[model samples]
Target: MDFEAMAEYLPLYKDAALLTLGIGWAGIAGAVVIGLAVALIVHFRIPVARQICRAYVELFRNTPLLIQLFFFYFGLPRFGFSISPEFCGAFGLALHGGAYMAESFRSGFESVDRIQRETSLALGLTPMQAVRYVILPQAVTLAFPSLVANVIFLLKETSVFSAISLMDLMFVTKDLMGLYYRTTECLVMLVLFYLVILVPVSLAGSAIERRLRYGSFGN
Candidate 1:
């Protein structure tokens, strides 16, 4: 399997891995914040804001992520803004994946009891206050599993960034394979590399779900 030849490509693999994580983590952090904010707006029926959020979700969700990436990377330059491919790629993920994440979070908000909303009204809490105090906390627990799943999905999506010369994992791997002709080894290790990140994330999500179930403030 040309194991010795593949081992010589360690530096290339390391660079790819670091770049992948940097972009993936940054994009995910943004997506989480934006997704939750949009989800809350829709879940609580926030007048014009709700409709705007719905429109955003539909627009992004209905579109292919690659097209979004291409638009940001290829098309935006026409507007006289010089953005790095990394920035375009990350922004695309934050915008596109944020839509799906919003839906996941919205489902969590749906699981909240109607009485909770009524009780907040009875207690003179503003709609914002109810969402801030009561709904978000529960929604986070419900949404945590799907959130973790999305993280893995987004991490893999960074592979697409390679198309824009982002030099992420898949890009470097492809280069290494082409240079050394160690396709099988490189591809197999790439699969393992992805799993190395994703498997722990899966385990952590499961652990959090169990804790949420058994610990204080049960859903």
Candidate 2:
């Protein structure tokens, strides 16, 4: 509860917070891309590709991020594949988040009427053009809520990145507490920093959701 003492660690927390955001956003962006790709493949039912994408979704969605991080950071070296801890953290989050995102997007894709594809084709749109102009936009609008939730989920998952020695907020908090025995101060800062990071996302998601609900953007 010592304000002066807590102020001393502001720089440390700021840096850690930045790192957390960098990794979290990077991972989330990658997840969205990977998820869309997987969803598209499965939605189109591309024989071999669909099975592979389905297996990927099942595997990553069913596993824990910590174990995945451990495998990437610790286990891979056994096979001579050495990745930096930062890459491992970001990549693991992407792979894990992608699985859940795939389901969310796939559900959205399915919710759209199949006749839209046929109609677009009858209008002389190529298959790829139909997906781009008709299918994807509607699917994204339908899946917007789930996509926002998944982004938030992935951001929180960044907490586990510390397990791999990345200087994320949780790592800095734990390290400071261990060194100074100021557990209360460290924990308060941890909560505050996380709120700082997550609250905006929640607000932004709500704002976007409202816009999509009432705005002509979806039309």
Candidate 3:
């Protein structure tokens, strides 16, 4: 194992790790927006919109994320639209993550009591206001653990961006290995870097779950 070679490349790997996290965070934010919208549509039984959301969730969830990224980065350019690799990667991650997130949000929405919505309506709140003020808050708390899990999964999946030359942590690691012929050292470093990021995130998720379960956040 060429530990010295790995040490020499540490700074570059650190930068790449940050880039990976940035992409993952952006994707997760986008996923939350998309997921909330889809979940709301289904929750309200919004006729055609609900069906469209269901189709979207099914399509993205059933397909491999790599193919989805390729379609955005490679296939779309074949037509007229051309987006940068970074944008394509982040957008692909968002769309794919959104599908799974939609399911989680849907389950969360279902867990909220129907009476809350009725109470909101009785208080003369508009449907939108009721959803915003009453139902979504509870739903979010219920779904948070699953949402955290999904975010972490998406973070790990960002490794796929390496195939499209995104220069993420995995990409940098691969480059380092190729340049120095230190596969074992590079792979070990890669695992350690990912663990450093993901372990804390998993721990934080658990803490959040506990707090929510115990009403520590005041429900």
Q: TM-score, each model?
A: 0.92, 0.97, 0.94
lDDT of each residue in 1-219, candidate 1, tens digit only: 877766776677777888788878888888888898898788768899999999999999999888888888888889987789878877888988899889889988998888888898799999879888987888888888888888878877887888888887788778877887778989987887788777887877777788887774333
User: lDDT values of the candidates?
Assistant: 0.83, 0.94, 0.90
Better of 1 and 2 by lDDT: 2
- For model 3, the local distance difference test gives 0.90
Off by over 4 Å in 1: 216-219
What TM value does model 3 have? Answer: 0.94
Q: Model 2 — TM-score against the truth?
A: 0.97
Candidate 2 lDDT over residue span 1-219, tens digit each: 899889999999999999999989989989999999999999989999999999999999999999999999999999999999889988999999999999999999999999999999999999999999999999998999999999989999999989999999999999999999999999999999999999999988888887877894353
Top lDDT: which candidate number? 2
Q: For candidate 2, list the clashing residue pairs, or say none.
A: none
